[model samples]
Target: MSMHQAGIIEKKDFDVKPYYNQLSSRTTHLKDIFEIYYRYEISKEEKFVMTPGFLNFQDIKKGTVLANSNGADVVADHASRLFMPLYQNQGNDGFFAVRKIPKSFLLVSAFCRKHRIDKLLPLLPGISWKSKDKDVLRVNKRVARVFAKQLFHLMGYRSKTWNKEYLEVRNREAAARYNEYQNEAWFRAAFE
Candidate 1:
């Protein structure tokens, strides 16, 4: 099935109790079934396969196991560690490389600043006023303007505008069967 179809399946609200119970009864090791499925899915040509959706702790733990077993690297902290190596590797060429700030770094910095502001709100009553009056929240104007575009690009997103007013961005990497259907006519018609 196409990644689009799989995504639709994930959005449906349905109880899996009956399916899970039946499958569990037939399997001596229930986790083995999950592992087998995970292996089959990842063995395909796709470079990446994100989980169906946001998962709870137990599901995340299980996914980590499946990923490790299938020789897939799972990054829990994508916002800091994802692209750090590229920056570190560019020794003398760092000047050119640093021109484009890593999206992960930007995201982490934004989160930290927001958190700091939140924490200081109670302790420092005039913090919000000072932040606005002094323009303390502003980063470089050029960087601020291009930050969202750069960040989205780094996260494998491509944007297109419809009707000249509505902007839409989709992550190309979100597809589990990207390689499998990339060359298909329907896939191109829909996504390309």
Candidate 2:
């Protein structure tokens, strides 16, 4: 891992030996990628920089300060470093549609994972709006459980599998309401 002053995202190799011994069923880690439903500034490279002391529940917005290892404040990059300790299958048919997984995840996760992420999120109310949206969970065990998929999008989740679904607005009232949702101050605030 490179020596970051205070706020660089560092990575380390996780020993999968014990993990292989204990949990032998599903072995998914950072190697997988996802996409945000919309765009935010932090999406860079392929990973989003998670804000310090924030939970995975809310969305990231503009003007939010994110941290690196040296404690330097950077305008959050719209991407995140994913750690897939087990996946090395980066063929052309790979999901990322880019190079094989960057080493950043392995290097950065090493340093960042040391800090407990428990209290880091469930994002704060923003200057423009507050979020009251309830969890939109379904009995929907469709695929990719956990908030990682959303988080992937928030960061630099890029994949052949992820694409933005475009919507068309034409109805006057519906358009107005759609505009309301679009322009909601929360757009610059956090996600539910």
* Among all candidates shown, the one with the greatest lDDT: 1
lDDT score at residue 49, model 2, on the 0-100 scale: 34
Q: Which 10 consecutive positions of candidate 2 have the poorest summed lDDT?
A: 166-175
Candidate 2's residue-wise lDDT over 1-192, tens digit each?
Answer: 122211233234344456554544453332333432322332223333334454322334554554332344545344432222112323221111112334666344333323422113224221111123311211112233434543322232233232243111111221234444554443323222
TM-scores vs. true structure, each candidate? 0.18, 0.17
* Residue 102, candidate 2: C-alpha displacement in angstroms: 2.7
Tell me each candidate's RMSD, in Å, in order. Answer: 18.3, 21.3
Worst 10 residues of 1 by lDDT: 78-87
**Regions of candidate 1 where Cα sits further than 4 Å from its true position:** 1-147, 178-192
Alpha-carbon shift of residue 6 in model 1 (angstroms): 22
Q: How well is each residue in 123-172 modelled by candidate 1, as lDDT tens digits?
A: 43222212422222222334334445544343344533333323344434
The Cα local distance difference test for each model comes to 0.35, 0.31
| Alpha carbon RMSD to native, model 1 | 18.3
